[model samples]
Structure formats: C-alpha cells, structure tokens
Target: MPTQQSEPLPLGDTIQRYGLVSRILHWSMAALLLWQFLGMGLKLTLGRTPLVSFFTGSHQMVGTVLFVLILARVIWTIANRRHRPAHGDGLLGLAARAGHMALYLVMLIVPAAAILRAYGSERVFAPFGFQIFPAQQPEIGWMVGIGDALHGELGWLMLALIAGHVVMVGLHQAMWRDGTLQRMAGRPRG
Candidate 1:
C-alpha cells in the first residue's frame, strides 16, 4: 500500500476559510485603518497637541498607502470570490453581505474624497516627499467642495460601521459560538 501525502496549503482563499493572501490583506487594512482612526480621534479630542501631531504627521502617506491597499484587496476579493467562505443564509447573512459591501464602499470613498481634495488644492499632493498630484493653477473649487463635503463625514461613518462590525463578530464568538473569525484569523484549512 502507498503512503498518503498531505497537500500544500494554498496562498489564495479556499471555501473553508481565507488563505494567506486574503488574511494578510484583511489584517493589514484593519491595522492601518485603526491607526488612521486613532490619529483622527486624538486630533479631535486633544486639539493640535504634539501627541496628536505625532500620530497625524504621517496621515497623508498612510492614507495613500491605504487607498492602494484597498484597490488591491478589491481585485483580490473579486478573484477569490468563488473560493472564499460564504456569508451563510437568511436575514443575518444578507445583512452581513450588505454590511460588508457598505464597508468596502466607504473604504474606497474616504481616501478617494481626500485624494480629490488634494488634487484640487493649491498645494502639491506629495506623500513621502514625492509628488503624485500637481497643484491646480486656480484650485478647482468643485472638486475641493465635493471632497471636503464627503471625506470627513464618510470617514466617521466608516468608523461607526467598523464598530458595528466588531460588535457583530463578538456576538458570533460569544452567542453564536461560531468560528466566524477563524475564516480570517485562523490557520488555513488543510
């Protein structure tokens, strides 16, 4: 009789759970988003103190990085859509799906609005000492207006959604006793 050999773990997602790439993207974005929120929260609470400045000093660069990561995550998600875990059935599942979609929407929009604001500003949009968007000659009022209107408002909205998401996950763990978090945080299923 031949001996059985185990298969190698996949880097992409599988039906049972998220794989290395998906987990990396998910956790990375989570951590970065937390940083952004913390910085902004401190700014709001503490005014322009050095402590707030310390966190916010890299805000633009971090936001730019987050935008790129969001794009990559979206592409990766689409590619892995068939293989990843399902949201499950019935009302809760539908709500989960809708909530996730909204989260993605706001994630894309928040940085996008800021980028638009940066593009329309008289100041050059440079992060990490490199220029990305050049300053508008007369400053595009419409672009600036849209960005100004949406960026902060939608950001706070995103934060609220994130809090809700975490609460739901906690419910899953405590009440449902489901391994929902394991989909992203646990080791890949064999």
Candidate 2:
C-alpha cells in the first residue's frame, strides 16, 4: 500500500502548533533579541549608570545565549533537515532563505567581531564579569585596531540588518500572504 498523505495546515494556525523544541527555541531567541535591542537602544539614548550596567550585562548574556542557541539550531537543522517536511522552493521562498542566511551570517559575524575586539583590546569582556572570552595576544597593534574598527562597523551593519529583517517579515506577512511567515510563526505541522 502507498504511504498516506497528510493534510496541509491552515494559515494562522502555525503558532499554536509549533513543536515543543521549536517553540522553546523560537520564544527564547525572540525574548533575548528583544532584551538585546532594548539594551542597545537604551545605551544609545541613556547615559551610563548602574541601570545601564545591568542592561549591558543582560545584552551580553543574551548575545552569548544566541551564539549557543544558534549553534544548536544550525546543528539541529543540519542533522534533521532531511526529516523536515517539504515546502516550496520558489522565488519568494528563495528570497526568504537568502534573507535568513544573511541574518545568520550577520548574527555570527557581529558577535565574533565583538569577541575578537574584546580579546584584542585585552578587555576580557565577560557577562557579569564572568570572563566568557579570555584575552588573546594577536600579531600586532594593527590587528587589534582592525578588530576594533570591524567590530564598530559591524555594529552599524547589524543595526541595518535587523531593520531589514523586520521589513522582510512584514513584507512576507502583508504582501506575500503565502504562508511564508505562518510556517515559522510557531505553528504545528499538520
């Protein structure tokens, strides 16, 4: 006998049906991103203080968490992608995939640059002073300077990338309306 085919899940129903692991990762990442944004946003407007210290630590912590979670996500995606249900791979889908790839690249690059910058500066910037990234002696002063410049420029780049991500999501939701957003909107597989 042939294998049975499952029905397609309805739009707007993805969020309520996301698998446990998927939901957990999704919400955790979302929450951390929110906090990180808040931390950075405040740092831009608000002056330094004990409160800023708290948020900064939180932001760094969130960044660290994102690194680990993204690593896990990447591993999980690689390991189980074959088992994942198939979806369209057309133009809009290609755009979505490319956009996500860009996001992940920016995500990894920005933190790494920050880590290298911290290491180059011998700052040992740790979350809550825990020394997450230890100092390292690189080639020369130019290496350190380059790391710092890259780190700062990447920060600006990340700001734009984030905005682009939001716009893309909005476009997928508003313009496409083809279940692109719904698929990842925490919905369950049918």
Candidate 3:
C-alpha cells in the first residue's frame, strides 16, 4: 500500500522573513532595552523621583533577564543562519552585518560585566529575590572596576548602535523600499 506524504513543518526563520520565535525575541529584547534606557534617561533628567525609583528598582533584574534572552537569541540565530534572510550584497550588506555584530557584542558585554561585578561584589545579588550569587568578602576590585569602566560606556554605545539600527530600518523602508522591517515585524506595510 502507498503511504501519503505530509508537508514539511514551517521553521523559525526563512530567507524572506523571520518566524515566530525570532520575532518574539526581537521585539521582547527591544522592549527590555528600551526599559533600561528609559530608566537611565529618567534618572538623569528627573533625579530621585518616585517614577525613577519604580523603573530603576527592576533595572538589575531586568538586565540579567535580558542577558539570558540575548544568549538564547544568539543561539537561535546561529541555528537558523543558513535559512535566514540574506543581508544582501556589496558595501550595504557589509555595513548591515557589521552593525548587527556590533549590536550583539555590546548587548552581551554590558550585562556580562554587570553580572560579573555583582558576583564579585560585597553585596548579594538577589534578582527577583532569588540569590544567584552570595556576597563576597573585600569585593573583587578588578571585577567591579571592569563593570564600572565598561557597563555604562558600552551601554551608551549600544544605544548609539540601536539608534543607527532604527535609522537604517527607516531608510530601508523610506529610501530602499526593501521589506527589511518585515523580517522581524512579520508584515509589510500596506
């Protein structure tokens, strides 16, 4: 007897666009990154207000969560790399790839530095009330120094990269007329 064949299951990435998992990770991280920046921006502008407290209160915990999500996203990207949409050809493609790499590098570094500092610091880091790392004696001055030196600077650099990413997306839509945003957005503009 002949057996019936079934259609292949859809994947989480495609040459034309991103899939559910990729879109979710992209938007979720975008929101979290925005939250981090918003809190910092408010802190600088508004000083010690209740609103700032509300946002800044969860900053460390959220950054930790973002770090984990980013790691997962990177793994997912690697797994889907072959099936993913092309960055395109020539200098524009090279720029796109470089920009994305820079973004990913800074994203990983900023939080990793902070977590490293927390691990080596005198204060216990109980993100969401669960102690991940117990307090250390005398603190690891070097670790804290690394965090102090890199975290904020790399964070601002990440912000600049993010802004460039956004502007490039806008340019893709406005000038190039490429459906670049649709890769993560899931739908082309009407």
Candidate 4:
C-alpha cells in the first residue's frame, strides 16, 4: 500500500479581486453587525445597562460607519461587477442574486431610516459637534412616525435577511465546501 502525499489546495490562486481594504471592511462589517443586533436586542428586551448602552452607542457609531461604508461598497461593486461570482443561468444562482439585491436595499434603507428617525427625535447628534444627523425639532410629525415605523419594521426584515444569509453561507460551507464563508473568515482555513 502506498501512503498518500496530498497536494496543497490552491487557495491563493482562488483569490477574489477584492483587495485587502475590501476584505477587511467586509469582515469588520459582519462582526459589527452582530454587535449592533445585540444592541437592538438589549434596547428591545433587556432594558438599559452599561453594557447595553455601550452596545447601542457602538451600534449607532457602527451604523454611521456602515452608512458611508455601504456607499463605498456600492461603488466598488459597480466598478468591479465583472469580478463577482459567476451567477450563471442557474435558478439557484438567480435567487441568490435576488437575495443579495434585497439585502443591499435593506442595508441602505435601515440605517438611513434610523438616522432620519434619530434626527426627528431631536436628539443632540453631535458626533464631535458636527451635527452627524439632520437637526429637525422633535415634534410629532407624521413623517417621523412613518419613518420610525418603517425603521422598526425593517429591523425584523433585516433579521430575516441576516438569518437567510447565514443559512446560505453555512450551506455552502458545509455541503459544497465552497469559499463563501471561508473568504469572510479572518484566516481562511486550509
């Protein structure tokens, strides 16, 4: 019987056009998203604590970061559309693309609506005295009500999107042994 000398996987050769900055931003955004969801959970259920406050404040900061980051992501995606994964004529792939587009829409809508709601609340959004949010007086405006309502509703929608995203990623990692999850990992496994 001969012992096998296995060849190493060609992972480096499988690299995406996504650069270091893009990869870093992608992972950081994913992690921060978990933290932000935890913060929202605390706000909804656990009530305020030092930890909750920390997470909420951090979530807001991260959300602000995300608002800008998503714009960058959009520009990058548009500029480098050719580098994207092969979304062939497969139905599953088409569905995946549709899911991606929905997620992107939610990404833009949720944070922006939250930001606007915060502005409507008339809270002093002075991120270093720079009026980080629009300064409108906190009145019982219908627009505020609608904004807040959709903002809250979008939370649940976002949860669904995130859950689906995770499930799909896990499915690819577990069943297909694909790089979906591995690429997002800090140090991709061999």
Candidate 5:
C-alpha cells in the first residue's frame, strides 16, 4: 500500500477564493479600521470621557499601523490580481469594481494625509513610543492644511463606503444567494 500526502494550503489567492495571506490582510485591516471608526465615533458623541480618551490615545499609533497594512495590501493585491476571483461581467460588476477602487483610494488617502500633517506639525510624530517623524520648528502650513482638510471628511466618507460595501455583501447573500463573502471569509474550497 502507498502512503498518501495531503496538499498544502494556499498562501496566494485562487479563482475560487482568497488564500491565507489575502484573508489575513483583509480581516486584520477590517478589525483595525473598526477600531479607528469606533474611537472617532465615541469622540464625536461623548467628547472627552475616559473611554474616548483611551481610544483617542491609541489613534495615531493605530493609524500608522493601518497605513503600513494598506501599503502591504496594495502590493499583495497587485501580485495576486491574475489569480483572484473575477468580478463578473455586467453593470453590477462594473459597480463592484468602481466601489472597490474608491475604497482603496480613500483607505490610502486617509492615513497618508494624517501622516503628512504629523510630519509637518510642531510636535513630534511618535507612535508606539518611537519617533518616525521629527517635529518641524516652524511647521509646514500646506502639508498640515491639506491633512486637516481631508482627514476627517474623507474618513467619514470611507465609513459610508464601508457601510455600502457591507450592505452589498448582505444583498449578495440574501437576494442573489451568492457566496460573495465566502470569497474572503469562508474556508478554502477543496
């Protein structure tokens, strides 16, 4: 009798579903983005309460981490573009593609703006107790201005986009009975 060997799990995406690396990046970013939104929402509703303070205190660091993750995700996405599931052919598919592009654009922009502001601010940009950007003596007005203008506004916009994304996923599951969520969240297809 011959011994049989099981195949290894995929690290990159396949036509059927996202692989381990893509799933990890997707879920991890989802969690971090949720934290960011929750903190900001609390700050808006409750002002300076201890709970809000706790969330806000870690905001910069979390944002920095998100920035890095988004960069990695972009790279990974480009690498796996040819192997991933298709968006389908139709207006719906076009919308899906457009929606995802918008999400990626805002995701990249939100943190990048904040980082630019931090780099140009009078105070040092220290996250996790280490300085990545030193304080500017005079402060760069344009950098700070662009960041201040875009960060909060675009953040809210991104939240709205995220809500739409979730609603669409629900629609796919409920109306179409499609395994759209499974592409990213479900167990690997055998």
Candidate 6:
C-alpha cells in the first residue's frame, strides 16, 4: 500500500520529509547561529563585562566553525537534492525556494568577508588560538573595506531572514497544519 499522509517519514530524505543529516545540520546551525546573535546582542545592549568578554572572545572562533559547517551543509544539500522533499507547488513554494537561496548566500558571504578582512588586517587574528593568517604589514584596503561595509549590515539582514524563517515555520505548523516542523523536528507526521 502507498504511504499515508500521516505516516512517519523515512530516516533518509523522502518525498514527505527530511533525512537525519538534514535535520541535524538544520538544527545545529540554528543553535550556533542563535548563540552568535545572542552574544552580539548582549554585547551591544549590556556593554563590555567579563560575561560579554567571554562571548565576544569566542565569536570569531565560533564564526569560523560556522563557516565550515555551512560548507558541509552545502555539500550535503547538493548530494541529497534529488531525494529531498519538495517545497510544494505555486507561489508559496517559489517564495520558500527564494528565501532559502538567500539564506545560503548570506551564510556563505558573512563569514567569508570577515575571514578576508582578517587575512588582510594589520593585526593577526588567530581563531581558537591557531594562527590561520599572519598579520600583514599594511592592511589591504579593499579587503577591509568590503568587510567593514558588508559584515555587520549583511549579518543583520541574515538575522531578519532567520526571523522570517521561524515565522514561516510557525505558520506551517499552526495555520496549515502541514507537519512541516516534523521534517526537522519530532517523529514525523504519524
């Protein structure tokens, strides 16, 4: 018999739901990104203190790790492209696809720009205390300029996109009752 709408999805990517890898990547990135924002938000609001210092200190390292995770996610996504659940039909689906594409683009660019800036900076940046790039004698103007201009601005924009993503998930769960959340959380539909 054909699977019912209420059936729990498979362990791997299926027409009805995401696989374990996808769900793991999705939620892990969500948590790490939340930490990044939370730390920054506290720094901005509460000003510098020992607690804030702790968070800000880890920010660069965590951001670097996030960049690596994003790369892994992209690779996994490409490998699973054909087997993954469909976004659905019509305008909502198109919007979902566009939103996801935007998320990916921003995710890739945010840390990349920062890393570029780090590479070109006059002061050495050693994330996790491992010197990835030695300090330059003179800062590269264009690299620093790109990072200075886009890093914070695009970071905020990415945050907005993340907010929209959460709202959309809530909509799927509440308004549509589509079991969309189950694709990433819970046990699946039934």
Model 4, range 25-128, lDDT digits (tens) per residue? 56777777788788889888978888789888766677788878887777766665765544446887898899989988998898888777777765756654
Give the residue spans of candidate 1 off by over 4 A: 1-9, 188-190
Worst 10 residues of 6 by lDDT: 3-12
| Model 4 / residue 129 / CA error / Å | 4.0
The most accurate candidate by TM-score is 5
Worst 10 residues of 1 by lDDT: 181-190
Better lDDT candidate (5, 6): 5
Off by over 4 Å in 6: 1-11
Over 1-190, each residue of candidate 6 has an lDDT whose tens digit, in order, gives 9974555445568766788788878888998899999888999999999998888878898899899999989988888889887888899999999999999999999999899889889989898787999998888989999988888889999999999999999999999998888777866666
Models sorted by TM-score, best on top: 5, 1, 3, 6, 4, 2
Q: Better model by TM-score, 1 or 5?
A: 5
Residues 1-190 of candidate 1 have per-residue lDDT tens digits of 9986645457998888888888888899999999999999999999999999999999999999999999999999999999988988999999999999999999999999999999999999999898998989999999999999999999999999999999998998789967788778864334
| Every candidate's lDDT | 0.91, 0.64, 0.90, 0.71, 0.92, 0.88
Candidate 4 whole-model C-alpha lDDT, 0 to 1: 0.71
List candidate 5 stretches off by more than 4 Å: 1-8, 188-190
Worst 10-residue lDDT window, candidate 4? 8-17
Q: What tens-digit string does per-residue lDDT give for candidate 3 at 54-82? A: 99999998998999999999999999999
Q: Residue 49 error for model 1, in Å?
A: 0.9
Q: Please, what are the lDDT tens digits per residue for candidate 5 over residues 1-190?
A: 9975645559999988888898899999999999999999999999999999999889999999999999999999999999998887899999999999999999999999999999999999999898889999999999999999999999999999999999999998789876888788875434
* Candidate 3 residue 99 C-alpha distance from true site, Å: 0.3
- Candidate 2: RMSD to truth: 6.4
Candidate 3 residue 22 C-alpha distance from true site, Å: 0.6
How many pairs of residues collide in each model?
A: 0, 5, 0, 0, 0, 0
Residue 14's C-alpha lDDT in candidate 4?
33
Candidate 6 structure, TM-score to reference: 0.92
